[model samples]
Target: MPITEFLTRNATYFKNDVALVEINPEIKNIPHVTWREYSLIEAARGGAFRKQLTWGEFEKQANRFANLLLTRGIKKGDKVAILLMNCLDWLPIYFGILKAGAVAVPLNFRYTAEEIKYCLEKSDSDILVFGPEFIGRVEEIRDRIPRLKDCFYVGDECPSFADSYDKLLNYCSSQAPSVYITDEDDGAIYFSSGTTGFPKAILHAHAALVHSAKVEQAHHHQKKDDVFLCIPPLYHTGAKMHWFGSLISGGKAVLLRGVSPEWIIRTVSEERCTIVWLLVPWAQDILDAIESGRVNIDGYELSQWRLMHIGAQPVPPTLIKRWKAVFPHHAYDTNYGLSESIGPGCVHLGMENINKVGAIGIPGYGWQVKIVDENRKEVTDGVGELAVKGPGVMKCYYKDAKSTDEVLDDEGWLYTGDMAERDEDGFIYLVDRKKDVIITGGENIYPVQIEDFLRSNGSIKDVAVIGLPDQRLGEIAAAIIEVKEGFSLSEEEVNNFCLDLPRYKRPRRVIFAKVPRNPTGKIEKPVLRKIYCGESVVAQQNEINIK
Candidate 1:
């Protein structure tokens, strides 16, 4: 079950089929680059898209690159960092490192210089391959990271100090290296967004990638002919894993350059994408476009689009209803997963659960889920922590055995810091994040319920509920609202909309501001909490209820 086996298996079965259809700007954004036969083709557009590499071309280049690394004295298990965007060069470079038996550390493109330095140093990466966009940032911390020996760029113009990725790809090396990589060897190190604290690097073995093909594609019913439209960044586990599933399923993975309602609609129609994955916020935008009649999607040939699945955040029930209303024939699914467990493999709300709204469906085929109390005893029906154990479970947090031991218990169950309840028939309902729960007057309040209620209102663009400091109650629920542009909503009106909610669950205070969230769509509660509670430490209750 090694991860590379998925690719090799697909390559064996569908060597002649279209594996990848990249949108190249240089080729007028057509499906110009096809990954067939020997390797992937490169497509560049408008200076923005620099060079094209074919599968055969890319395979040879990657071998040369691998040989280059080998010549540089890089060895098996050595970490190589790829700090670039979602360009054609990025993924090939990653696979090349894997081919050389090196662990690929993909850093977030939006990370600051300090954050990038931390990841490179923490992973002990010896080589950094980045684009020119981050040259200044890299220069700031280049001297600090001692492990960094070589720097390479993807753009046509490489600085005097760094090597051009094009030169390395064009270098002639027909001989491929023979490297023995086991399933237990680390394949990737994905760092969490450092919004709250320093980011933790989550490690995944080569076997973890293979599990995606078995669990996700099998459960979701992905076929070889299915064309997938990916809007999220590949750095996140969900996007990368989804793309991997498409490849293993022998489907075409269509990646959008950027997410826009118009661009997404066009891509789906033009590519004839059968499966589409999106975040909740982006999903909301599509709904807004259809509702507002801003996008002319009616005349588009969208019949080919079959399933629209969203993850990375809890799907609001109201949003689901609106999505179904727009495209009655399209299947809508809400999956629940975390990076620690190899995204979206544990639980899924499949298309068959159309009538079962608001539930995260059942446990995945090979996974086991349990709701447990604080004492770690399994709870029959009530809400509690969600613990899952399965083949999809990650080995551990990279190098942080203590943190790994904290979350993953001796019994092999990894305690997801999420609160969920399961029905008698085994349907799981996500209540709210355990860390996001608000406690008021010693009662438990899940913010998801309140946020869903707020999102139901047409005027609300986005909503996040957090517990603000209260001297008497210790903590009280506060609703932060992001009013839709051109729509004015009063605090009284917003609060009145919550009259149907219980008294304790209602927000004690309402603020209108842009709420910050991580790229994965999880709310930064610690940041929100810091806004209410000043820099100084203050004593408060251990937990508060606001649901």
Candidate 2:
């Protein structure tokens, strides 16, 4: 069944119950009249500080958008692109596209104008619905993209070249469009982070989306009363798929606009949020704030917070250890996946298996996992490329068969270009990305090992390890350290701290620099590689699979 069916059912059964909340303290200062034109938008009980939607309103807004698309001649399988930040309209617009039998293509808000044009032409998207923040960028490429036909502006004082979504949605009917949808039909297109080069389009079917909803609810056991706090960009798959839990259970969720430790804790306390999905860096910042007296731990009521999970990168076990120490009652989990596999649930670490904290856990519900060598043979207790087969795997890398074939194989296994090892107990641990492996003197060195070790130092805030050119050795491990503010660590100190690591795996070069992380919290090693190595590794790193 289509994912919209869930929204429709919730609208009927839980019409008056709150389905979504927009706790945007950043937008609180903006005048309420600015958003008054938007019909689906409404203030919460406390007013403009929190915009919200009931289940009934959620379905109605989606229906309006769907009707708007269908009336504009949108047909089944046509692509509609969305370029917006995390907000109440984001999901409704997404559902609206699916309801109209058109595929929803969500673009990263950080895309450059050229990148946006590339994606528009690549995805063959004719209709792009963007917000005010993206107006300048979209304008620069609006005429450049040959296929682009319509642009819907989502903010006040809409641009002349674009139609006003707020105004247009009000004129459409609030009833579901008469369209047929199926589990196997195309539903959505997601773009890879494009850290290596240009982003690739990942395609998924409606069944894959439905599978994620089921997997999330099964994994976290989301209840009707559960309120989830989401902080990541919804343009990416991680936040949206994690929110699938609330969608499945008819629970409420808050789309938080800020990431400050104080703000996060305040929203959780004020909204009575029971579940939160955080990136590793955000979680670390929260812990650091509380421990350093930057935040008054006693000021917030956190007793209602039940579960906290992290995903998109190899979570430092030490971080989770600190989290558990702070909130012993909280259930913690780790999620691992790629856009190709429909976000972070193909292999998930459940709290039940807390003993395997460092491992990425076993295959998720209705999923199969294997660690295979280059010979296409399975490896036991050895590092190799990780592969997964599941209901949520993408159908293909849209319009790119060669790229799709490189990762996905016949019989449906998606080969994740991540080096991993299976423990004797069957838990899997990610070693590094396939391209991130540094070969020194024929010895394969995983940077994560050295990076993880260096992070143990209290003085280090963040770290990235990459290969710098070495004449004698094929490549040498280099560590770029981001020292914490008010803290200092010398190269000697970082080296001494790495005494725990094997000699060959130690970073030969240490430099104090900022470790860049993309929106999803994955280290931008390609950027570091380009900066330090004086060479772009874009070609070698293009196949990088985000989890």
Candidate 3:
């Protein structure tokens, strides 16, 4: 069955149950505004978990939006671009597109006018829907998007050239139009991070999310009563498809407008969120808050918080240790996945396997995982390219057969560019990306282990380990670090801190600069490599200098 069927089925079984709880009622009054607020006094003010929409109401709104798309001449296979920040309206628009049998093309809200226009042209989007806050940006490109027939904006402050989202829905019928959608039908198209070059459009089938829910929930042991706190953007597969596990099991999904330490603590206490997902940086902030006594876990009745999962990057062992020190009773799971493979649906560390720290655990049920060499021969107990074959694999990269052929083999195996090694116990540990491996003086080094070591240094704010060109050796590891303000350190100090790291794995040099990170918090290594290699590129790292 497809993801739409899971949602439709749950809407029938758990009609009155709360599906999505939106805690942004205060923002309703703020027109044409989208900004993050952070203060020492307030800590985190949003995500109070007061406002909510039940499953029945959610389905009704999605059906209504589906009808609106059909009324606007959007037919099956038509792509509708969704360029908006994370909000209550995001999911409704996404599911609405799926329900209508139209394809959803999720764009990064951070894209500029030029980038947005390029994506629309590349995907051939028929319609564009964005937030009112981006009115100026859309206006700049509205005339340039030739195939863009309609534009709609959410919120009270609608742009002059676009129709109001809420007003448009009122004119359309509530009933969803009948469209024959099969399991193999393309349901959504997600853009890559475009770190290496232009972002590629990834096409996923209707069955993608359904399989993701079963694999994640089955491995994590999610229950109907579990309240999953979703902090990542819905445009990403991790937050969107991964949360389907909770919804399919009649669990409550709490959506935060943004991720902050205070909001995370407040939500866990207020909503009794049992399952939580976070990136390494966000998890580090929560641990810092707890250690500084700013957040008192005992003050809140958070005994219900059980499973906490981290993903989208390698888990620094130091972060896990600090996390365990704060919440000794909490179970932590680390996972590895990508957009092409239906998010973090492939490999997962089970809640019961918390003792197997630093491992991405074994492959989820119904999935076949193998490590293969350059000749495509399977290898045991050695690092090799990770390959997966399962229902969760995406259909293909949209309209790019040449690109799809490079990754997906003829026999249905998808070669994940990530390198991994299996333990004697059959557990999997992600070494690093095949592209990220650094060979210095005939010694090969994976950046993840060294990066994990560097994260333990107190002065290092953020770090990205990348391979740089060398005269003698083919490449050498260089650490680009972003330090906390008022703190100063030298290359010798940074090298000494990693003395415990194996001689071959230690960084050859350290450079002080703010490392750029993608939206999902993964360091943009390709951008960094280009910066050091002097390659002309489309995207550069966005760095924050020390005050």
Quantify how close model 2 is to the true structure by its C-alpha RMSD in Å: 11.4
lDDT of 1 by residue, 484-542 (tens): 99999999898788887767778998889888899999777778777865521244333
Using lDDT as the yardstick, the better of models 2 and 3 is 2
- Compose the digit string of candidate 2's lDDT tens values, residues 344-373: 899999869876888899999999999999
TM-score winner, 2 or 3 = 2
lDDT of each: 0.74, 0.85, 0.78
Position 342, candidate 2: lDDT: 94
Better of 1 and 2 by TM-score: 2
Where model 1 places Cα greater than 4 Å from the true spot, the runs are: 9-16, 24-61, 172-175, 193-196, 436-547
- The CA lDDT at 72 in model 1 is 78
Ranking according to lDDT, highest score first: 2, 3, 1
Q: Where does candidate 3 clash, by residue pair?
A: none
